[model samples]
Target: GGSASSGQVSRGGGGSCAFGGMGGGGRGVYAPTHVRSPLSPQQVTAEIKRAQSVVEVLRVHKRFRSAFNYIHLSATWNVLGRLAARAPAWLQQHAASAGALREDTHRLLCELDAQGLSNVAHGMAKARVTSRDMWAASW
Candidate 1:
């Protein structure tokens, strides 16, 4: 048995200390070994453009599976959203015509539906159609 003040439990020949006891045993704080640098405006724009192009190609092919990996598309969209959230005013203004991004997302949804990937499509549909301004507001 252990006393609250002593924070020690005796069993057999050994004793174990509780939290805040003489000996401490708790989870260590998380610290990243490498810190990622923020992307430049140009880089963000380039990534958005690249994702747009890929989606365009997929739409033209009418097959998202062959042209794009689901995980990759998801990750790219995530990155784009994060970048957009931090975009400057000038970049936000440029992102106003996020029509293409919306269109591509719709096309992906259609492709997923056609492929009977309803579960994945449903999950993806929850993600808002990203516009540069939308991302900026998210922050």
Candidate 2:
């Protein structure tokens, strides 16, 4: 471990990361962090932090998954589709899927004639009948 040095880490190499070789090879005799060994304490901490971040991101997506605002935020899907025309097949597929899903949802919800879903609960007595016998669930 004498080959290692202890001091504040600094940016180095024109096209390198603070802790890893170019292209994130993540190698060097001396680790960028102070912790050492196979299960180095620093690596463990970074891993835990990364896991937590992923969990948090998933949580937020879950909460907003059904929100119309997020789904129809902008012409983003449409733009993606048009721009993906010359892109790779995978990207084109992604854009197409997004646009299709958005359109399908927009059509399905068209049964309820309103700019958007309201987050209020109206009494059963006030329920409006618009079809043979259908009721839109309140959010």
Candidate 3:
């Protein structure tokens, strides 16, 4: 076991996070700066749309996977298609996340309208995601 450094603070719950020293003649205690509000579904959808790389897409997906509505889910699928088209090699290394996204999409299939399902199918084709479960669910 190592000793906690001056810049390290235990944030309770048995975890310690490293924090920069407090300057400006202030106490060296850690403060919660810039706490993020959760992004709304529309905001998340927009984020998915604006993602330029596989890593960005996966990061957003992992962050908001359980919060996605059908619209957000559809948008994620579409962006994944674009990502696949733009960077097939880079996307290959993230097959696990892709598979998890597939599972999430699969669970929400019934919520998608015809056009949403169409977009999903089109995206899957573009991304070459030939999962039998996915194809069968779209039927």
Give the TM-scores of the predictions, in the order they appear.
0.28, 0.21, 0.64
Which digits, one per residue and each the tens of the lDDT, describe model 3 over residues 69-125? 556677877887887877765435776776678666755554455667678878877
Q: Residues 1-139, candidate 1, lDDT per residue (tens digit)?
A: 1122232222222222222112211111111222332544344334434644333322322322223322234444554444433342323344433444434343332222122233333322333332433433321
What C-alpha lDDT, on a 0 to 100 scale, does residue 56 get in candidate 1? 39
Which candidate's TM-score is highest?
3
What's the C-alpha lDDT at position 85 in model 3?
72
lDDT of the structure predicted as candidate 1: 0.32
Model 2: how far residue 115 lies from native, Å: 13
The CA lDDT at 28 in model 1 is 18
How would you encode candidate 2's per-residue C-alpha lDDT over 5-118 as one tens digit per residue? 332122346534332333122133223443223544444333323332323322332333333221132222223233333342422334443334334333323222122222
Residue 125 of candidate 1: its Cα lDDT?
Answer: 35
**Segments of candidate 3 deviating more than 4 angstroms:** 1-37, 89-91, 131-139
Top lDDT hit: 3
Supply candidate 2's per-residue lDDT for 138.
17
Ranking by lDDT: 3, 1, 2
Model 2: CA > 4 A from native: 1-64, 69-74, 88-139
lDDT values for all models: 0.32, 0.29, 0.61
Worst 10 residues of 2 by lDDT: 116-125
Error of 3 at 24 (Å): 58
Candidate 2's displacement at residue 117, Å, is 18
